[model samples]
Target: MKKLLTASAFLTATSLLGMVGNAQAATISALTGYSTMGGASTGMQVRVTFADNTTSTGVWSAVDFYSGAASADGWTLFQSGDTFGNPWTFSNNSSKTISSLFINAIAGSTLFDRTNPNPGTTGSAAGWDFTPVSGSSPTSFTYSNIVNLVGQPAVGDLYAALTINWDSGFSTGSNLSFIADTDSAISVIDPSNPQPVPVPAAFIGIGLAGAFLAKKEISRRQKSHKA
Candidate 1:
């Protein structure tokens, strides 16, 4: 009977885990100050390093990661040694345009620390490769996959002072603001005036002359009729 009960418990646990996996899965990041550029239309791969030395890669919507004012928009990725593990890597292919990316890893809260001295790293089209921001001791260190423009991967080594936490129930992590097209200026045409067709000087002059001649001809005809 004891063995039977044990078996039943295991089966029940397995079923629950399966259901969790099948679900959309909780977010790793919060939606407080969640702001995105380029409509967060692009999708990027987010990889997590598990404690067992195994890793899992999943495609996450760039908009899910929020970046805005330093005081707001901070989210947590994982706990020090949670199920998702520590240390993560983000990669975007040529298909996606990532103009500017800023990652700040701090200790206080799981949310990103834009105000802290350790503003983790900055990623560009060249690659996700970056060093410490000038004069700051960063807890999280990141390396790039390759220095190529075609495909760049930003690998963040969160194996530092801050205790990494992985809450499977969360949407995403940190105060991450990704500007897909920061280098280029987006010029939105005014909807009110989608197209402003300017009248040419010659066309205006021709229109005025025609109106004047028509009025003069009408007056002459009227005078002749009266005579």
Candidate 2:
């Protein structure tokens, strides 16, 4: 009975120690430098970095352009071209025209468009509209809740998409530009519990003292029974 009691106490302490060892880690970052260049591009390159310090590069062609106009009616007017490197360029011919431009996540289906009158038109003279396909356009641009990549981004991850549109015979002098942006790194916690240090020498001494008292009590009871 004494041995069983000691074993039980030891097991309880061990279990608690194990729990202290295990805890979860989380992290996040933003994709930057995704933009459109106005007019025909000789070449372009866009870089994207993940929360884990992983990176991927994208090359764009001429036909791929983004546009912002009075309405969707003007969307069909842009001409498409081939991709060369990172910069998506449009045909330099006088007939080709680009109205607006912006960048979108390659895996993301949502499109953000910026086209409104009044106070909305203030700041960033760049007519480039940021639109999300599903809902209304946002009043400002902000990044949050970034995706968790299983592993570091691969070459074909499609970090972002460059969209461009042009109207025939409308040389409005519209183009897209790529800007470099950086995201803050996130801290991740380990999910596994940390190993607990063995009971200190002092703690062990206390435990032994308790056990001695318990043994003494048992012996005293046994003696009384014999009496």
Candidate 3:
């Protein structure tokens, strides 16, 4: 049986800075964890390591990783641990434009294939190639394949679901607010669950709706039992 889990993310920033209108860059950091993976027999992999010391893994595991800060409206900078699992250091001049998005590891980073079981490193174009999807517009861009190559044969047919869902134009939004939205993101207990429902106030309606539905269901059950 699959072990479903839950995750929550919090943004520790009050307001985003000049990451939008100008070329100023900022770093948004977060300590992740408080998630669980599926059973061990399913070739599950670890996705998130939380501050509470609990971890989550799964088949193409759903990890509830978080960003520590908020982002601005325009464009921002974000870097994840590369394929080789090295520590990230923010440089003085390390800023990438929208056109700089690539599949291979960022400069000074190594390439890795998450889908591979015994994955070997390769170039971004060769290993994890990324291309703009067919229906991309000035405001929204979608790429069906975040990673081109699969590391493990078991997950060859499936691909990862990564998204940079911002509410403004990619070319015109602020960088700090963009990362702040990412900071308030969330992950699911199962792959089948709705994704990216963050822990910030942005998603309070979702929580309230879920609670109301659950309460309604409980009241209905009680009335049925009374009969």
The candidate that wins on TM-score is 1
Q: After superposition, how far is residue 81 of candidate 3 from its true place, in Å?
A: 6.6
Candidate 2 minimal-lDDT segment of 10 residues: 14-23
Give the clash count for model 2: 39
- Lowest summed lDDT across 10 adjacent residues in model 3 is found at 177-186
Per-model clash counts, in order, read 18, 39, 29
lDDT of each residue in 36-151, candidate 3, tens digit only: 11111122121222223333222221122321111222222232322111111111121322321111111111112222221222221111211111111222212222222222
- lDDT of every predicted structure (CA atoms): 0.20, 0.23, 0.21
Better of 1 and 2 by TM-score: 1
Once superposed on the true structure, which residue ranges of model 3 sit more than 4 Å away at CA? 1-152, 156-167, 170-173, 176-227
Candidate 1 local lDDT, 54-151, one digit each (tens): 43433323333222111112222221111111112223222222222222221111222111112222321111112111111122222111111112
Q: Residue 107 in candidate 1 has what lDDT?
A: 14
What TM-score would each prediction reach against the true structure?
0.21, 0.19, 0.20
